[model samples]
Target: MFIDRLDAGTKLAQALKDHPLVQKIALADRLVLSIPRGGVVIGKKISIQLNSRHDVILVKKLGAPFQSELAIGAIAETGQPFIDQSLVNQIRVDDSYLREEINRVRAKIAMYKTKFRQDKELNLAAHLTILVDDGMATGETMKAAIAWLQGQEKTHSKTYHLSPTTYLIVVPVAASNAATDIRALGVELVCLEESSDLTAIGQFYERFDQVTDEEVIKLLAKN
Candidate 1:
């Protein structure tokens, strides 16, 4: 288990370096997108190790109507939702509920975008983009983030030249099922620990603390 975010970040950096793609691409052509605010901690360490660019992607979970913390899906900055159809059917979610949640999370994503990326936009064209997070639960949030990136990839590839290398996702820990789901995106996924019976992300860490927006702002400033 990791002692904290820094420790996790350090170990994750080493794992990323050991990947086969590390020798295939130039460091200048790589970019690391962190799912803040905890992921930024890991991203910072990775950027330093690989000498790659680092930025934030604002994606959030689309929580269930009754239980605000239970994620039925997730939404990205693009205002699109990635829903779990099986879960939706089992819970009998209506179209209206999905619409409301999509807009709600989109608004939150906008707020975070304005607060975090006030100066510039993330440029994924012609670069090997790596999405980093502290860990995953249902993997809804990360899935939405990847879907959003894939949307950009499809749109921008028609106009600009994209790299031939595959995209990547790295995390300190993740659920085994979620890891498989993430790999289904056709990206190289690197998780330090893929637990079969995962409960909480914090369960694998010795000191998992709250990462605030202010802290994320400061951390990004350093990079």
Candidate 2:
């Protein structure tokens, strides 16, 4: 268990220090892309420890109709959406609902990019790209970021040379199922703990509090 997000970030940053990829990639070539607002705390620690660039990766969960807490999937800032077909099929979700949710979630992502990043674009030309989150339960948001990065690699391979040697996901804890799904994406993962019967990410931290947009803005500014 962690005392708070700061403690989790410290531990995760230490773990990254011993990672094989960290040994191969130079500090200047490492880019830490954190998912706000809690993940920004983690990302700050990582960037400081690794002496790398830090930035926010905007992605929002697509909540199910009448169930805002339940995520059907997620959409990233690049407008790439990852829908959980199995969940949608089980819930009998229709295409129209998904289309609407996509538009709404994508709009929120754009707003975050403007507010948190001031409409600044990310530099994807790094040797190692690290994605950090406080913890992962369903892992949809992180997957959305990965999907968008993969798309960039394909689309800008020759034009911009945007392919990184490695893409790593770091989190203090992750649900076992979500870990498996994330590994299937072919990215390296550094998880301090994997819970088979995971409930909520807050359960692992004693001082888990909601992070505000203002706090996120400050953290990004520090980077």
Candidate 3:
């Protein structure tokens, strides 16, 4: 367990130093996209360590109706989103409700993108993309984020105008099942821990405070 996000970030960076990706590609050829708000903290550290450009990925979870804590899928503001078909069926969600949820989530994503980011977007065709999050539970949000980088409508605040070539996922910890799901995405994942006993992500940390928007803006400014 880590003392805080900074401690987790340090450990993650140390573990990544010997990775073949770092050894093969020059750091200048990488771009990191962080899933805010906790993710930006770790992403900034990894970006600095890899000497890569960093940006934010604006994504929101599409929670199942009547149980908003349960995530059925996730959506990106300006690109294709992803949903778990099995979950949708299990929840007995109608097509009309699903469509409505997608629209609602997309609007929220757009607001976050506008509020947190500006005129810039990651041009994925040029550099190896890296998506960083604090950790993973269901992995739905991260999956949608990956799709955002690779899917159609590769545009953002402006037209991003590119397609994904190669990408990586980085995180401090994830549920054992979540790690498996992430691996199925066909992207390399660098995680500090994948534990079957992971009841919650905060359980693996000593000081897991909420990362505020103010903190994200400050870190991005420094980067």
Candidate 4:
């Protein structure tokens, strides 16, 4: 198990150094857009190691009603919301409720972007954009993030006429099933460990304390 997010980030950054694409890409051409507030900790270390720009990509989980800890799916700041139809059906989530949740989450994402990010613009023009997170459970939020990047690429092509960014997902640990689903999205994934019996992300970390908004802001400021 990792000593903490910093330990995981160091290992992940080391693994990234061996990737063929990362080896070829210049540090200036790489951008680390991590999901906050945990991901910012990981991303900061990566950015420092690689001498790359660091930023946050906002996405929020759509929690199941009553069981708020259980994620139904997720919605990115931009792009279509990703919902697990099977899970929704199992939990009997209705369309109206889903709509309301999406709207609510989007608003929260907006507030976070403003609060945590201020007026910093998203750097979508990087040659390689690495998505870092503490871990992947259902992988819904990461998928939503990938979709958002694709949408940005489409919009960018019309104006700047540039090649699409090479998207990569990096995590300290993940469930085997979630890793497979992430790979199916066609982006490169670098995970330290993939376990079939993974219970929670915190399980793999020796000290998985909650990352605060202030910590996230400080990390981003360093980059």
Candidate 5:
């Protein structure tokens, strides 16, 4: 009932505000990161209200060949990314196909970096990182993001001389199963609504228009 009954982003924000886990962590004092296209609007609002650093954590999904809407895997902000191994195995995607998709996603990330390099100077060392997306269905993108964060911690530990920071994943709405799966990753999760009513993320949103890359770039510039 919480799903499809209110403004997706606002409701999600409020839910996070009320959650005991969120209260314990005090997200208002942390660095809030979000993936573009979906996370930009939500992240901006949260940043303004909470007085936290809102930055984009670029993640692009690798769509199925010919059926581009079907996500097979996802790439995170860092160069490291992941795919649903079971899905990849079930689909019988060859190494060439996987490489091609990976390269495509990397190219997209490169373009994003080129456009927003100036905005990447925020100090993530010892700062709490909150990752946001609009919603979740398969949890592939969230998994990729978590994996990427681990890699970043490993690679930057020496240079930054900081221990791995805590991460929290927030979303407006998510499949009950998907939320559970994400929580099992041993990270804090803040999901506002969990329902079987979810078919697609857009279905619950009253204003589910596409967020362009240009808009994301502009948002980053402002922050």
Candidate 6:
């Protein structure tokens, strides 16, 4: 039982089963868009259980100055990722600095897109999009992913005549306030653990290994 609990993949699957949003969206029809790296493992398990389309959404965070683990912004599949402007301004990050970081992220996105996003444009119109991540501390990455999805809805409306889009955010653990902020975006949010006492995401899990780009690519290749 201890080895069973220590398995991140198994724990992730069980957590998703208990998640309210997962119960609602992991039905017969839906697509799961998991955040790259850690989320890929969770997404794979969910895909097996739900028998639905599963794909990865590459979202990279722009680290805060002097505190690299602290994210001030994040880049999703789209061109411009979401940035907590107020936080950036409060931290005294000038526009030039932000631009430099954003451009760097865009380059990374381009590389990922070439490697992974070569499929037909995701027709999220009238489809359920479930966004997943391994964990959440600040929620900057999830926020950016949501904003990017919204942008896709708008841009695709002009070219492809499709209906509105629906999205959901699913994570294993998240800060209470960060979960609240994500819920305010008017989309369904699922978190197995929401603790106000939380400080770091890795603290909640026993094995929090760093996932590399090559590993992520290999995982997604199975989809």
Give the number of the best model, judged by TM-score.
2
Q: Which stretches of model 4 miss by more than 4 angstroms?
A: 158-165
Candidate 4 C-alpha lDDT tens digits along 53-122: 8889998789898877678899887636888888999999999998999899888887888877785567
Clashing pairs in 2: none
TM-score of 5: 0.84
**Winner of 2 and 4 under lDDT:** 2
Residues 109-195, model 3: lDDT tens digits: 776776677646545533467788989988899988877666543535244433443677889999888899888877788898899
Best by lDDT: 2
Which prediction has more favorable lDDT, 3 or 6? 3
Q: Lowest lDDT 10-mer window, candidate 1?
A: 158-167
lDDT for residue 65 in candidate 3, whole number 0-100: 88
Per-residue lDDT tens digits of candidate 5, residues 1-223? 2333225556666766655544665554467777776787778766666667787777788877776666788987766767877888888888898899999898988787777555354355535677888888877888787777777778777643223336778888788878888888888787766887577887766667788778777777777
- The weakest ten consecutive residues by lDDT in model 4 span 156-165
* Model with the higher TM-score, candidate 2 or 5: 2
lDDT scores in order:
0.83, 0.87, 0.80, 0.85, 0.72, 0.73
Ranking by lDDT: 2, 4, 1, 3, 6, 5
Per-residue accuracy of model 6 over 135-172 as CA lDDT, tens digit each:
88889998888887777667776653222235667777
**Model 6 pairs whose backbones collide:** none
Displacement of the residue 173 alpha carbon in candidate 1, Å: 0.9
- 3 or 4, which is superior by TM-score? 4
- Which scores higher on lDDT, 4 or 6? 4
lDDT of 2 by residue, 1-223 (tens): 9999999989988888888988888887888999988999989988998899999888888888888767789998787888988999999889999999999988888899899888888777787899999999898888888888888888777643345348889999999999999998778889999999988999999999999999998888887
- Candidate 3 residue-wise lDDT at 192: 86
TM-score of each: 0.91, 0.94, 0.87, 0.93, 0.84, 0.84
Pairs clashing in candidate 1?
A: none
